[model samples]
Target: MSWLALWLLGAGLCDLAHSVRPARHLPSAVGAAGTLLFGLLAGLSSGADLAALPLLAGAVAGWGYLVTFGFGRGRAPMALAGYAVVTGLLLLIAQQAGAVGGAFGRWVESTPLPVLAERDPEQVLLLLAVLVAQMSTGNVIVRLVLAATGTVNPGKGPDATSTLKGGRLLGPMERVFIVGLGVAGHATAASIVVAAKGLLRWPELQARRDAATGPSIDDVTEYFLVGSFVSWLWALGGLVLLA
Candidate 1:
């Protein structure tokens, strides 16, 4: 396994652990720390295996931006969409930049030490698909499950998603279920990407005004649905170019 992948996997685990405990700020703090640690580790691990580093860095940057700027007060569907897009863009930009050296500066220099270079085109494409799904679903599940379980309580007043601000939505068993669901969702998306382009297309486009005609079920359905679709699209693009 790539060192950057290991570090990121570890950090993601830490974030999950922190979400388990709501009484203490330690969980959130640990999560933030884990994000930063993953970024640094990615930079250090890049070497010649640049792709791994970008995936890790993108995840870290996405989480970092969400934690830093904070989401809007209203659960307005548009606001939520904006938030998700911004987070996704931050991650994508960071991953692309750091992986192949865009604007973050060349943090990793080539060296002569033997490294486990994964050159299989098919494997590389699969890895990219899995990595994107992992980060996106991991994040969404954390929030939804945490809120559902009462591990984190939605704050008083009108916010989107749930009724609690901070708490795990489900218990240990349910949390496991969430993780499983995330993995399954990733696989499902990948299969769709590999199968048909039409399978990934979303709901029909709506006029800006007609968008509000419904009960706004779009809040929950849109992000995950569109997100999963887009991630696979990204993976497909990578696969066509690389694989």
Candidate 2:
């Protein structure tokens, strides 16, 4: 089978594991096995030398998801640790695979999209912009969804805190930490992509929502907190995969 085909299979398996875990609550070992299979196949396509890259990424992702969602009270340390573990594993795979070829050299040559390729600055700056855009956009989108679904305060006049309560957004602390961790992950992955391909794409700002208010402060805070994490995931994924 082709490498890309193998990657597709692995990705499918990974998603399957994710889907089954919530309903069936499969054993952690089963999930680990799935990740192992995914890593093996994904490494084949990525030319990542680390034989265990898939396992590592899966474990980190699982831990992050669990700590933030499944068990704990959404600690920042867990999020940060998860990001570090995943990114480090990816880099190790790249190195082992001998894929780190002329990272900075390629940036001078060409890019996939002339427009997005033009914005190749330090990974930190790029990461920041992408993260901000993601959070802001997600906040707006989630708010609209809530308002349309009658979940949030309607007809305006509510403050930002009230409007966002019960909307799946995390509290202020969680939001800040998750955003920071996500940006870090993006930077790490972006660095790898840039090093390998020379060119990368910049994410665009798509939307913005009014910070309207609602009745419940607690609900809005939670919505913002949850939404922030989601935003981080979206932004980080886009930077690493889309770029």
Candidate 3:
């Protein structure tokens, strides 16, 4: 569980660093290296068998590579598929090692926070991973989906800066809201959030329809619909993991 926390924290920091234009590959590289080192240290501290260390290190390294470089360079579908595979493998390893229970579970149970008190460490780690994904990773997924579906063309008309102002901030906020509501057992409220987002964006979308220049209404609408649905799906998927 400590190793899981370290990996997630590293991944989240890497994603946050990559969000800044000036701090590109170096931050991610350092994060990958750090995750490997810290994960090993965590395993050692937690008294995990030495035999499992290599596999744990390898999994952390692989996850770092996927999030930082593989996803950055590879096709969207392939990268996303690889992410799912690696995540599943890591969870399996954790489960087998008994790292998903025991001390970590006790710690979580002792914590006073209502949101976390009932959660096992594995679920908490998974929630943290999901939150991190909702940040820059979510943006990557949305853009990749749009690109794959031909709803958006790279290096063409109104770049992200000119067109989708504030989307980066908005995407994470909405995902967090949805995930929080769902975790609190407010599924209907989460649905309302989904509808409200569409309503809020409707005016802008309609304005685009009236404009002569910029991306066509159809293109913008497709981008919004595809991106929003994929983003919501990621949050919902996280909720499923918590369950």
Candidate 4:
């Protein structure tokens, strides 16, 4: 669980760093350093075995670096998804060995909150990490999926996002809302909210249908559907991972 959380944290922070500066190597370097530092913290706190720290840290750093360096390539999304699948396998092996909780579990018991603070520390940490991922990392994945699916052409330059506008921001907000509702045990409500997004964006999509510039209505509609569905699945999948 800790490893998965760390992977998510590394991904989200790496994407945020790249979005902030978009440098050739700065974001990867920052993410790797941050992941390693956090790995050391986990070891020191006995949240993970000392002997396993090196391997865990290596995984986090390697994946983080790859995320920064893999963007814009044809197979980048597939590669990233493959790494996620591998991480899941690693997590299963790690859990089978023994309990993953330690000092963080103890710390959670010490928290003042009656509800949230009483929950598992790894859960809380992962929730925070997923929320962060929903911001930038999710957007990155959606764009990659859009490109991969031909809904938007990355090679052609300026995908629907540039024309659609507000997607990069609206996406995070919507995903966070859905995740929050899920956490609050309002899955049905969350689904309703997800449905409302299409309605809310209907006018905008309709407006594009009659436009003379920017992405075509067909392209924009596909972008909306694909991106929204990807984001929804990502948020839901994160919850499943936490489980």
Residues 1-243 of candidate 2: C-alpha lDDT, one tens digit per residue:
111222222332333344346443343344445444533432333534354445553563464244324223334444444434644554444434422114332542355644435544223223333343343234433343343333433224434332323323342223334445444444544334223321211110011133233334444444444444454554455355324
lDDT of 4 at 100: 31
Give the distance in Å from residue 222's predicted Cα in candidate 2 to where it truly belongs. Answer: 7.2
Per-residue lDDT of model 3, residues 1-243, tens digit only: 444455554655565666765254555565566555544433343445344545544554454455445434345566567656756665666544434445545666678998887776666766776677677767766776675566764225564325556777898899989888888889679988889988988887787777777677777787778888999997887677667
TM-scores of all candidate predictions against the true structure: 0.33, 0.35, 0.77, 0.82
Which pairs clash in model 4? none
lDDT of 1 at 48: 39
TM-score of 1: 0.33
Task: State the lDDT of candidate 4 residue by residue for 1-243, as single tens digits.
Answer: 666666677667777888899787777666666665655544434434554555555665565566654565576677568567757776786563323345555666687876567566667767877788888888877877776676764124554334556778888898889888888777778888787888988988888788776677887787778888998998888767655
Model 3, position 209, has a per-residue lDDT of 78
lDDT of 2 at 184: 45
Q: Name the weakest run of 10 consecutive residues (lDDT summed) in model 2.
A: 199-208
Best by lDDT: 4
lDDT of 1 by residue, 153-193 (tens): 21332443332112222222222333333334443444433
Q: Scored by CA lDDT, what does every candidate get?
A: 0.37, 0.37, 0.65, 0.69
Report the Cα lDDT for residue 17, model 4: 86
